[model samples]
Target: MSMENAIFLQKNVGFCNALKRICIEGFEYSTLYKRIEKMIADEEKKEEKNEKLLVDLWECNLLLSYQLDSKMLSICVPCLLKFALKKEEDEETPKEVEMALLSLSNIKFYRAEKELYLNEIKEIIRNHQEHHNLTRLAYQSAWQFLMNRSLVYRDLKGIVMNELHFAREVGKELEEFAKCVDWKKEKEEEMGKETKEKLVLMRWFHVLFIFFGLCNLWNEEFIGLVGGIAWVLRAAKENHKKISEKYIYLLGNAAKRRDVKVEGLLKIGVVDSVLEEIQQSTLNEGVTFQSCHFFLKISERLKEKTDNDELEEGNRKATKMEIFEKLEEEGYDDTITSYHEFLHLLKVNKIDFDAISLDISEYFVNV
Candidate 1:
């Protein structure tokens, strides 16, 4: 049916009621599928096109796909990806591309369909990696694709962390995310007012890196994140505590790896930021423990380097001493002591263990 007719039917009570009755009487969705196929074939002709039809068809597909599971969506995948990857033909992005990506993200895919189209989906994301209009939707689509598969395949988790180059992506996103925050701005202004898209991207980074840490995928390259991670942690600490804690837990997981150097993390300002988090008036035991766990891991790595022949003797001692002195100056000594005391309290039943809700270690092993 033409979109005009569809709109008319939607607006007319009698026509809508009649259509509903027919649908209830087991009208085959194949009719809609045939109409969609014809539209796509016509779209492929590359003649003058009805932009409204393209957008409406995609939006209609998305809405209907949600309300009723339809295999016809699989047929639309290639056309959707093509439209989503279309070059900018005008000043504004073609509305169909965004609609295509949004539709792709919402469609439920079986494992077989994902395997069939996964590489194409990944290519679509890479093609638009820098596109202002499409980048977020591209990743959102890919994220949804992998997320659905990861539920059953398990190994796709490693694919997202290892093969996806999320570290590089995070670097780019953080560079953009930094522009949204102004240190000179008042604390209240900076607290929770970050753009929703950037905030969502931050959470994505947290999850991606958590997998990165758990999978032991942090190479020297990824270990070099300087201010970005710490900025994300501190920026989210006040109003977005859940993500802040996730980042802390991610840092703990990363620190647990022997290859992740303490100095790099120190350069990232995580040490100071974590210490600041520990000293927050609203202390969270889980965050404190994870913070201490990070310190413990770094201290152990430093101690090992100090005791072993990994570094030249004098330099090793100096570096370890310098870091330790800095930690002491930051009151890390008191924080560690407090963390130990808190653990003791939990052990002795003085502090309720139930209050410590986030079990970060599980994320490490499960992934």
Candidate 2:
């Protein structure tokens, strides 16, 4: 058989094999996982194949009797996205991928307490350590955690069950790789030692997490919110930092394309002020306009605290009728839309709004 045909048949065979092993009569994680990977790779191999592959993958997702390892596809999706971003020539697609990954950036599950998903594949690693067999079950567990909201495993305690039935199959090969390394030579090799130390230092924080996590490790669920937030924030911050002037211009252009708010802001004499504020904020020493959203979230509170005296008229709660009538007379569309877009862009861009020049975007735009 041709290699291509062989691969196709292999996928079907693997899927059927997986199906037979599933607790559910026809649940098959391997088949779905391979199918998804094949579809993506096939789409990459030939442009003509893109639509067909998308349809195939969608159908595979739908027809699968259960999610099975499809949940693993959630984690796998970002990996594919990363590869796509690197390989694809299209500009528009990366932004869509970015948004999709951001939305799926979270995986929350209840273990003993709760587990907030991070980039660490610790579960996989831990599985390898306990079970000699890295069977489909382990993969399914990881997959379920990623895709299924972990409802099945919810409220479970993670008492590292004794030696897994098949730990030798997976970890054995990995262990062989470790043995291949010459520890004496590796230690004597300055560059190798330095690199190892660097990696250790880099991952020190994760070590801290596992250490501290021991307290609630046996809890019904595990929520790694702090770790997850740190991972996400770091990723967003890194990606935003990679933005060039051209990229920002594109962003601003996109904002301009969202024209309803900009035009309305101008009509209300706030457009120039808001833009100027954003510009000044962006130019502030070591400041990013992305930070603007952070300030925006609490801007009203800050205004109340620090700018209270600025309101010489004194503070008084206006009746709904008064507030609405005033807003209507001034046209709330422009002000509301402009501010929302402004702050949203700021947050999306990961700017430190708190550190930027205050309200500069809102300043001259209003004039």
Candidate 3:
């Protein structure tokens, strides 16, 4: 079917349900795979002149992706990889590239030739990380593959480092947002132009989400990047709630890591930022839960470090008392008060701390 006809069917009978029904009612994988192969062969014969056929095939690939299992879909991995790899030698359509990546992203269960396909996927990510229109989809696919395969942390270090570098570079736009002294004026400006600004804001949030994924690796290089964690803290203090929630998630992950030294987080004021979010009455429950969990983690880590006698006196002070003193030096005395008050409120209300801890932890588990 053409894209238009498929969209019409989707509109009439919800896309996923329609696809499921098709899958149930004798949609033969081998036959469909042969049809797609024929289409690809035809397109290649014309030297990529048939954009319409390629698009229809892309739509078919997308439809196939919703199903959890398909042998032919597994076999089609090389063909999808071919589309992705073509970007290196010749310019490809942005839609085709995105569809190819999205198709790869949807293949959650891998059955065929894991190492060969994984190396190809990694090459796609490395070569196209700089693509103007395709980077986000590329990263999304990489995240999917990494999560599904249970790949080692080392497998993703390069991608994580690349994303952090991108975050730091694109993060410069956030400085203007950080410098806005009047929250009311900033809110007004944001609301007035929200339609145009929404895409840009979402792009930034995607970058932060990628950072949240990296925190699972628990790499010291990510934590120790000069302005990496600081940029996230600054974002948490800004006006956007979605962006702030992502920052909270990144902070929560950083605090949860058992291997890395978290002093960089403290020096960058992650504690103060989490406290600020918790004290806010207007934030969502998800944000509040993450902030409280982050607070608890930091407090626990501090206690653990304080009890360790192997550390020198100055190191102890830097990790414990002096960090809070740094908060005071930055004039966050009220923030500290609010932090204490929120903890007291949690205790008094008998809020299940265990329940709150899973909100962020569960998200990372699936990712």
Task: Give me the candidate number with maximum lDDT.
Answer: 1
Query: Model 3 misses residue 311 by how many Å?
Result: 3.1
Name the candidate, 1 or 3, with the larger lDDT value: 1
Q: Could you arrange the candidates by lDDT from highest to lowest?
A: 1, 3, 2
lDDT of 3 by residue, 1-367 (tens): 9756854453334223321223333332556545665765677679546654564464465545345345555545666676666544345565456556555555444556555476777666655545544544444444454444433344555544554343443344344433433444657776633332333344344445545555444344454432444454455454666656766766776676765456766765666666565545465656756665575566566656444465643565567776567445655444445655766797899987566543332222110
In terms of lDDT, model 2 sits at 0.34
Question: What is the C-alpha lDDT profile of model 2 across 62-158, one tens digit per residue?
Answer: 2343443435454344443333233334655443333222222222322322233423334443544554333323232332233333244422213
The Cα error of candidate 2 at residue 147, in Å, is 5.5
**TM-score, prediction 3:** 0.60
| Alpha-carbon lDDT, every model | 0.56, 0.34, 0.52
Show where candidate 1 strays beyond 4 Å.
1-79, 91-110, 113-115, 130-164, 181-195, 206-210, 213-215, 224-227, 234-243, 276-293, 296-309, 312-320, 341-367
Error of 1 at 26 (Å): 22
Off by over 4 Å in 3: 1-65, 88-92, 129-133, 151-220, 224-233, 236-238, 275-281, 305-309, 312-314, 326-367
Q: What's the true lDDT of residue 332 in model 2?
A: 44
